[model samples]
Structures are given as structure tokens and as C-alpha cells.
Target chain A: MKGRILEVARRIFGQYGFHGTTTRMIAQEVGIDISTLYYHWGEKGDLYEAVVLDIYEDLREQLFEVEKRIHGLPLDKRMEIAVEMMTDYLFERPEISNLTLFRYFAKTRHASPLDFRVPEIMGNIAHSMGLVSDKKQLPPDAKMKMLAVMNAIHNFVSGQNFFLTMLDMDEKEYVKGVKETLKFLIIPAFVHNGATTKRA
Target chain B: MKGRILEVARRIFGQYGFHGTTTRMIAQEVGIDISTLYYHWGEKGDLYEAVVLDIYEDLREQLFEVEKRIHGLPLDKRMEIAVEMMTDYLFERPEISNLTLFRYFAKTRHASPLDFRVPEIMGNIAHSMGLVSDKKQLPPDAKMKMLAVMNAIHNFVSGQNFFLTMLDMDEKEYVKGVKETLKFLIIPAFVHNGATTKRA
Candidate 1:
């Protein structure tokens, strides 16, 4: 029952948006009574939070595992893993990708706007940056530069229009382009700086 | 009267979204009859299109003027103009900015999506790349790389979440960061490759 509710909720919410979606509609889609929904999730707001949180937790698990694998990889390799991990994670659940990053962020009146926390996502970024910082490879300024580049790529993939348009690239080609971006455009500036700033 | 209608339309459509907004509400807000609105703009869809198109045209003009002023300037100077142009264009009418980029982009059942038909936006990007292509003196592949970097910056600025959270930096500082990112991360790669190819 819980899984059914979630499946229906994801589809409806993705199609109609959070504001347009109503609990009754979700209940109807789930083929359950309204009382049953309240009994399970307490209320509509609670249900919405749960649905959003589930995606975050799933994303968190994936990101954490990637972080673990690259625990002590060098700076460039770590960045490459980070980019690939983010792209793969987002692609796995495009609906969740759209909901979390695009739909909610685009809205003027977001539910629980003040408390819309994604600490796990931030943790992954900070962890990635830590790997670079610990390498003592880049200059002091390179950490922020690396973070900015990663953010730009993440934002691009999270965008629906851009991601859809990029369907031209096969998975291998896509990953290749991503690595090429990180390699040629991103890595060198920090690499040289890292060598010089080893002490600092 | 037309200007008054547009002002009310911007606010109303923003809150209710394009599909949710109506000619009646616009007319009521402007103290005019529904018939008066149709007399002026023919239909609700026509009026909505006009509202969004006007904003797009305004932005195009603002970008064009900035590009003209920055002609033959250094890469950094041209970047500064691009940032200033985006800041001024969005800040002058943040409502229109949100409506055009965010609200209109949202897929709705009944509403036609915003089609910003102005070709100059792409032209400006191509021309900017042309200038940087000379500076970098790279082959065609490097030029494509330069375009991607600029596109990433464009997406970053136009993105709603980035704008909302970036309150720490004033427009000028934020623009400076973009310029620096372009200069350090992007221009250098192109220049490096271009130099390599030239030597080869």
C-alpha cells in the first residue's frame, strides 16, 4: 500500500506539480480511501514531505557510497568520480531530479520553504572539496573554484531542458564529455596550483 | 491603459500562473471591464503572449546595447558588460524575469509555453565566442568548448535557486565571479589549446 501510494504520488506530482496536486487526487490514484491515507501518513503535508525526503535519502545513500569508493583518490580522479556519480544518480530517477531541483526550486510558494534542507547533498560536495584540500595540491583559491565548477555541472544536469537536449550523447559519450569537461576545462588550473601550494 | 493592464497581468499571472490567471482578474485589477481587455489585446492568450514577449524583447535590447558598448574591449571588459547587462535586465523587472524564465517554462495543460522568438540571444553568444576564439586562437573544437562554458554561466545566472541564494554578493561582485570563472577556467583552456595547435 505504501509503495502504491508513492508510485501514484510521484507520477501525479511530476505531472501536475506540488501545488496542483491534491491529497484526494493521490488517494483516488492509489485506490484507497482518504481516511486510509491519513491513517498511514497523517496528512497531505506529511505525505508530501515523506515523498520528497525518500528521494533525498535515496540520493544520499548513492552519493555516500560513491564518496566511500573514492575515499582517498587523487584530486582529479575524485572530481571525475563526483561528476559521474552525480550524473548517474540524477539520471536514475529523472522525476525525482525534476521535483527536487527544478519544480520546487522554481515555485514561488514552496511547502516548508524555510526548512527545505539538503544537508546530505551539501555533505557530498564538502567531502569532495575535502579530498581536494587534503591533497594539498591546489592553491588556497582552487577549492572554491573546483566547487563552483562542480556546482555548475550539477545544476546543468538537474535542469530538465538541458538534460533532455543532451540525449544525443550515448551513455559512454555522455560520460566521456563529462570527464573531458572536468579534465581539460577544470583540472589543470588547480593541478599546477596544488603543486606550488603544497605547504599552504 | 495597456501599460496598466500589463502591470496587473505580471503580478496576477505570477501568483496564479499563466493557466490560472484570467482576463477577468486582470480587468478587475485595472478597474476596466473584461470587454475592455479583449478590445485592447483581443484575447487572454494573446495578452499573455504579449506580456511575455515584451519582457523578452526588453531583455534582448538590454543585452544588445551592452554588447555594442563592449565592442573591441578586452575579454574581461566584455564579460563585465554581459554580467551588468544580465543584472540590470533581471533586476529592473524581477517579476518579468521570474515569469519568463521560471513560470512560463513550467509545463501546464492548457497554457502554451513561452516561445522567446528573438534570435539575437544566440547571435550574441556566437559573436562572443567568435571574439574569444580569436583571443584563444583555437580550432573549431576549442570554440565549442568555449560556447559550453558560456552556456553554463548563462544557465547559472538565469536559474532561480542560484539567484535567490546568492544574496551575499551584490550584482557587481557576482558578475565579477562569473568573469573570473570564465577567465580562469575557460579562457585559459582555449588559449592553451589554441597555442598548442598553432605551435603544432
Candidate 2:
């Protein structure tokens, strides 16, 4: 019962966001009493915190798997795998992008304990991709580069309806194209950067 | 009075989005009565539509100027100038991205006459960048490429708060870094593509 509630909460929060969603809505969707939801989750913010943490954990897991595979590959190869793996993970659960984008643009951010942990995650990615030597003090350029990669993935997922219509593509083609385009655009640049740095 | 109200509406709508925003809020911010606001624009949706149209017009004007300047330039050079100019334009008025993202993710998209005109815009842009020759029946790949570029720019602007915090970059640095990063990633990929096609 607890697991099911959490799953529903994740989807609902992703759809309407924290402000747009109400405990009543979640409970109604779960076909349970609102008080029952409170009994399990405590409060709306608490449930939201759980959802954010869940997403973070999932992202970390995906990053770990990606890191394990691309640990010692060339920079371009690492980026190719990372972009493919991350885009796949995010696309499967696009709610993650939806919720994150909502959090960014939300007018009044609800007070919550769990946040995106963006820097920590970016640091891990920068280090893993061989862009930064230290996660503790990632360079602005490295972080910025990671930002470019991440922003592309998140936007492609979040803006699906708009992008699909604009591109006249089905969902399947959109996914394939997103991965191809990211590689075509990102890999060579970073590979060139890697080469330039080695020469420098 | 009407013009002032539209300006206020654009900002508020960008901030709170269409669903989250209300005529009352706009009136409050504009320091006018609700009746006065309605007198200028029929209702909430009417004013929102006006704002969308206004943004589209601004984009068209910018595109025309971009075309005039980069008409006969190389594809890579065209992309560089376009990215620089468009990023500058969008950053100055981020509400355009905000509202567009909002509209895409918006549940129960409000009924409005003025729409994004995404295909038309993309075709014009793709042609200008030498990705496609026709504004009509844009090839799937061509549209996808344009989507990649547009998605990168929109995400960078829309996710500014989240991205800036993660990157630990000041606003000025963030803007400069974004432009640089886009050029670094996009210019080379397209340039290579252009070069390959020329050889073929």
C-alpha cells in the first residue's frame, strides 16, 4: 500500500506539480481517504520530499551504471554512452523532467527538505566524463558544459508535446532523433576540447 | 493603458503561467481595477492570447533581422550569429521561454487563438541556417536538427535559475557561458555536416 501510494504521488506531482496538486487529488486517484494518505505520508510537502528523493536516487543509480560502463573510455565515447543512457532513463520516466522543470519555473517554491542536488550530481558527471578532476570544486567551464548536456536532455523530454508537433514526429522517432542529435552535436565538440587540452 | 496592461500581463503570465495567473493578479500588479483591465482586453484568455501574439511578432521581427544580416553567410557562421543574437534576445525577455514551456507542460492548455506557430518558425530558421531549403514540408531530419538547437536554447533560458545555481555562475557569466557553450557544441557539428555534404 505504501509503495503504491508513492508511485501515484510521483506521477501526480509530476503532472500538476506541487502547487497544482492537492492531497485530495492524490487520495482520490489512489481511491483512498485523504486522511489515509496523511497517515502514511504525513503531509503534502513530506510526500513531495519523498518523490524528489526518489528521483534523485534513481538518477544516482543511473549515473552509477553509466559510470561503471564508461569509466576509462575516450571522452567522446564516454559522452556518447552517457548521453544515450541518460536520455533513455529520463525519457522512460519523463515525469522526472516534468517535475524538475516545474520546480524551476514554479512561482512560489514550496518549502521542502529535499532539493535537486544539482551541483553534486553535476560534479559527479563532470568527474566521470573526465572533465573535472575534483568534484569538490568543479570548474565553471566543466559545470557549464555538463549543464549544456543536461539542459538538452531535460528540455527534449519536458517539451515533448511542443517539440513533437513542431517536428512532425512520432514519439519513437523523437527519442531516436534526440539521441542522434545530441551525439552529433556534443561528441565532436567535447572530443575536440579533450584534444585541445591534451595539447595545451 | 492597453499597452501597459499587456506588458504587465506578459511578465505575470511568464512568472505564474496562464493557469496560475489571474486577471485579478494582473490588475493588482498594474494598479488598476479589474474592469479597467477587461476594458482593454476582453478576459483572462484574451489578454493571454494577446501576449502570445506579441511574443510571436517580436520573434518574427528578430528572425527577419537575422536573415537580412546572415543571408549569404556560411552555415556555421549563420548558426554562430543566430545563436548569439537569439540567445541575447531570449535572455533579455525570458518570459518567452517561460510561457512557451508553461504552455507545453500546461495541463488543460487554455483555449487561445494565438498559438506558438512552431513549424513555421522552425522552417524559417532551418532555411536561414541552411539546414533545409523549404519552409513547407520540412524533412523529418531537418526539423529534428532545428528542434535540437531550439531545445538547447530554450532549456538554457528556462532552466536559468536551476542551471545558474548548479554552475555557481553569476548572471553575466552565465549568459556569456551559455552563448559560448552553444557555439562550441553546435557550430562544429553543423559545420562538419555541411563540410561532409559539400564533399559528397
Candidate 3:
């Protein structure tokens, strides 16, 4: 029951955002009494935070698996695999994408607890891409370059529907095109151009 | 006063989204009575649509300026100038960026009245980039590649604060890095590599 409530809460939060979503709506959707819902999750804020954290942790695990699988590949090959994996993951679970965009526009004045987890996940991916060393330290220049690459892929996947409508392409063709374009952009910047390795 | 309402509506709507904002709030913020606000813009929906249209028109004007400025330049130089102009423009007027993310996540069930304007804007950009000729018809492959590039830049600038926080950099440094990285990625894909002009 708790798991089911969390699942529904995530979808609602992803779609409607914190201000737009109400505890009553979530409880009604879950077919539970308001008090019962509060019993499991203390407040609306607590439930929203849980939903956000749940999404991040799931994404982190998927990224970790990608890192593990691509452990010893060369830089170019690793990037290809990472981009492919991330694109598939994002499209399949579009709620993450929606939540990401929601978080951006919602503009909550305080920092989210989930916010800190992003850099750690990015650091793991950056290390896998050879943009940072095993020490997980990125110099200023490499940090910026890696962050740019990350932003491109993140936005490409999150903004999929908008792009699909804008470009007027079917899903299969759009996904394939994104993969190719991402590779074209990223490989040149990070691998062939050697921008990642150049120190600040 | 009507213009002031529209401007305030754009910022508020961009930040809070449609459901999160109320007509009363907009009216109060504009320091006008509710009837006066309704007189200028008939309903909440009307006001929201006006705000959205206003944003797109402003952006369209900016893009037109870029197109005019970059005329007669070689393809690579044109791309560099366009990316720089766009990045700076988005970062400065981040309301457009926020509204864009809002529209994506909001997922209105019907086709937006504003949907048609996107392709028209993209067509103009494609012509300027030489991805489409004066004929203004894009091959399917060119269309996809061009859209992917557009998405990348759109996301990069819109997702700026999120990326800035994730990468733990000051805003000035982050924007500069994005400009450089966008050029590095876009130049290779569109101009040097000939990805755009290569037919489907």
C-alpha cells in the first residue's frame, strides 16, 4: 500500500508539481482516507520529497549499472554506450524527464535535498567518460565541458515530446536521430577534440 | 496598463505555470481591480495565451535580428554568432526558458494554438543555418538533425540554473562555458561535418 501510494504520488507530483498538487488529491487517487495518507507520510512536503528522492535513487542505480557495464571501454565507446543507455532509460521512464523539467520551472526558493545527489551522479558518469580521474576530481575546464555534455543529453531526453512535435517525427525516428546527433556533438567535444583532458 | 499586465503575466506564468497561478494574483500584482484585468484579457486562459504568444513573438524577433545580422557570413561563423546570441538572449530573459520547461511538463492534452508557430520559427532558423535553402523545405534527415541542435541549445540555456547548481559554478562562469561548449558541439555537427546538408 505504501509503495502504491508512492508510485501514484510520483506521477501526480511529476505532472502537477508541488503547488499544483494537494494532499487530498493524492489520497483520493490512492483510495485512502486523508488521515491514513498522513499516517504513512507526515505531510505534503514529506511525500513530495520522498517522491523526488525515489526518482533520483532509481536513476542513480541505472547510471551506476551503465558505469559498471562500460568499465573498461575506451573513451569514445564508453560515451556511445552511456548516451544510448541514458536515452533509453529516460524515454522509458519519462516521469523522470517530466519531474526534471517541473523542478526547473517550479522554482522552489530553497534547495531540494535531492539536488545534491545530481552532482554525485554526474561525477560518476564523468569518471566513466574519462573526463575526470578515478579520484572523481574534475579541473575547472573539464568540469565545464562535462557539465555541458551532461546538460545536452539531459535536456535532449527530457524535452523529447517537445522536439518530436517541433520536428514532426515519429518516436522511433526521433530517438535514432537524437542518438546520432548526441554522438556527433559529444564525441567531438570530449574525445576527438581532447577538450576534456586539457586542464584549466 | 494592458502591456504592463501582459509583461507581469508572462513572468508570473513562466515561474508558476498555469494551474499554480490564479487570475486574482495576476490582478493584484498588477495593482488593478479584477474587472479591469478581465477587461484587458477576458479570462485566465486568455491572459495565459497572450503571455505565451508575447514570449514567442519576442523570441521570434530576436531570431530575426540574428538572421539579419549573420547574413553573408560563412556557415561556421554564422553558427557561432547564432549560438552566442541565443545563449545570451535566453540567459538574460530566462522567463522564456522557464515557460518552455513549463509547457513541456504541463502536457496539455490538445495541440497548443501556439504549436504552428514553432515550425515556422524553426524554418526561419534552418534557412539561416543553410540547412534548408531559400526554398525553405527541409528533407526529413535535415529536419531531425536541425531539431536536435535546436533542442540542445534550448535545453542548455533553459536548464542553466539547474546545471549551474549541479556543477557548482557561479552564473557568469557557467554561461561562458556553455557558450564555448555549444560552439564546439554545434559547429562540428552542422558546419564542418556537413551533417545538416547531407540528404536523407
TM-score for every candidate vs. truth? 0.70, 0.90, 0.89
**Tens digit of per-residue lDDT, candidate 2, span B24-58:** 98999999999999888997888888898888778
Candidate No. with top DockQ: 2
In model 3, the clashing pairs are none
Lowest summed lDDT across 10 adjacent residues in model 2 chain A is found at A106-115
Model 1 residue runs over 4 Å out of place are A22-39, A42-44, A103-105, A108-114, A129-151, A158-185, A188-199, B11-47, B95-105, B111-120, B131-200
**Candidate 1 interface RMSD, angstroms, 1 decimal:** 5.5
For model 1 the local lDDT of residue B32 reads 97
Chain B TM-score of predicted candidate 1 relative to the true chain B: 0.63
- Candidate 1, DockQ score (0 to 1): 0.25
Q: What residue pairs are clashing in model 2?
A: none
Best of the two (1, 2) by lDDT: 2
Ten residues in a row with the worst lDDT in model 3 chain B?
B107-116
Q: In model 3, which regions exceed 4 Å deviation?
A: A108-115, A195-200, B108-114, B195-200
Candidate 1 per-residue lDDT, tens place, A1-200, comes to: 88788877776665455665677888998899988878877866667767777776776677677778777777667666766776676655655654553432344343454354443355465566343334323332343354356545544444435322323344555545554655666555445444344325
What does candidate 3's lDDT look like per residue over A108-189, in tens digits?
Answer: 5345555446667667767767566653665555665665665566666767777777677888988898788778777766
lDDT of 1 at A69: 74
Q: Count the backbone clashes (under 3 Å) in each candidate.
A: 2, 0, 0
Estimate, for each residue in B97-152, the C-alpha lDDT of model 1 and write its tens digit: 45543432245556575555433444554455334334323333343354356444
